[model samples]
Target: MTDNWSEVDLVLKTMVSTCLANEKYFGDLDSVVGDGDFGYSLARGFEKLQAQYDELDRTDIGTFLKKVGMLVTSRIGGTSGPIWGTGFLRAGMTAGATTELDGATVVKMLRSAVEGIQARGQAELGDKTLLDALVPMTDAIEEALAAGATSTEVVGRAAVAARSAADATAQLVAKRGRAAYTGERSRGSVDAGATAVAVIIEQIAEVWKTRESR
Candidate 1:
């Protein structure tokens, strides 16, 4: 499977579309434990991002990803903006001028993204934040890759683990963000941010699976 810049673009577009489609659902989930604007922020940000998609430099994935970070940071709201923006920016830096990413490269990029989020958010595992989903998913991908799994398998495994981790957030006590204000009340509700993380990873896995089949 040739996971080139064009394929990455398609994957990003898919992520935007998917986030738009589930906007209301995300809002509803956030309403349970947060300020309830997570969906609107994500939808609006991605909409603007889609408008500027063609402006990204296609020759370098690093430039494209950095552009993505800037756009999301400028347009998105709440904590999602900075967290996601930092992640993409760090990933872009790690990618440098590369136009294509093999499995190892993908692992490195994702690890950088995770590290960026950690540095920016100051959150860790069991924080009832996106980290709850991202960290586990990244670990799953790394383990799969270490076991000689195919790219498709690695992404698929990560997605599945991310979904489960997102779901597990409902069982965790709030420790960060607005959810922390709820204290015990935050329990039993899914985290919108974690769900968003799962959704994007799932979309990436889906894109890769389709690409590999072709």
Candidate 2:
């Protein structure tokens, strides 16, 4: 089944709640390697986005997603602003005017987002950045979709993969972002960015599951 704008709205709400609740954890993760502002930045940004959520155009997914990108970029601070902004912006463009998304469509959108993040961040798979989580998540989504899984199933599988990737970051020496400055010391601590990515992906999956249950 195709997913609607209402589902997108629910996903955003879930993300806002998830980010706010885990803000301190994200900050703690970042404090070990970076500026310790990752959680606060996401909380502040998503809260602002939530405030204007009702005003967003719900007719077209592309327009809605583009608005989200602009809001995050303008309201958030640090490297996360541009990286997430570019990712959402590219995903929106890839989605075009679609009002509903299917398994294949979601995969395409995620792939575009991953590519955009890579272009903006210049990060690779093992960089211990959000890409470390997002890339594998997208790969899993694509695989699930190819196997004829529903959109919900695709996202569920992807979220699990993303979480695993985020956890795996603990063993990697960061090669990008502020964490890179720690050299080998970055190992043993999860990348805050990757954790954020996994958390958001899990939130999306939760929203979908909740919707399906209802």
Candidate 3:
């Protein structure tokens, strides 16, 4: 179980670093079918979070996440801002001032985040959006926890599931975002948002494995 704010902080920091490092890679993926700004937009938002990391509220996990969500919403540009921001906001709301998080709580928070993304973007499974990866990732986490896996093991499973799901989006038709405008042309390329989710989860899992080794 991730039972402290410091661990949560570490995960968020890793996410920020991952986004910054992959800015160009993500942008290139987006250029395939999207407006080519998904990476730029996400990196810009996370840069703000990185810049003000020390100043963020740490009263609790929920408060911290809510602040991060608000920053992402206001600082990021384009459609990516609201959809991603809503996920953080809803996850924080579900956490509700908690200081400790068990596996079940984490899964619940993830579910809430996924729902928020769906509601904000009017997206669903098979939409070829980030949801394609995120939903499967969450399910893998839940399953890993149910099977009595360690936190690192659960994250590893999630990373695999997210990557597989993201890759599968290459076979799907874009049904959301600017990619949808491409019609059949979008079928061969993977969704940038989904790929980003997979990359992020993979980074998290890698970080967790290193931490466990230490």
> How large is the C-alpha RMSD of every model relative to the true structure?
1.5, 1.4, 0.7
Give the TM-score of each candidate: 0.94, 0.94, 0.98
lDDT of 1 by residue, 33-83 (tens): 899999999998899988988887766888889989999999989888999
For each candidate, the alpha-carbon lDDT, in order, equals 0.87, 0.87, 0.93
The residue-by-residue lDDT of candidate 3 on 81-156, one tens digit each, is: 9998998999899998889999999999999999999999999999899999999999999999999998889999
Q: Which candidate should be chosen as best, given TM-score against the real structure? A: 3
State the displacement of the C-alpha of residue 138, model 1, in Å, after optimal TM-score superposition. 1.0
Q: In model 2, which residue pairs have backbone atoms overlapping below 3 Å?
A: none
TM-score of the candidate numbered 1? 0.94
Clashing pairs in 1: none
Error of 1 at 183 (Å): 0.4
Worst 10 residues of 1 by lDDT: 1-10
- lDDT for 179 in candidate 1 is 88
Worst 10 residues of 2 by lDDT: 1-10
Instruction: Kindly give the number of clashing pairs for every candidate.
Output: 0, 0, 0
Best to worst by TM-score, what's the order?
A: 3, 2, 1
Off by over 4 Å in 2: none
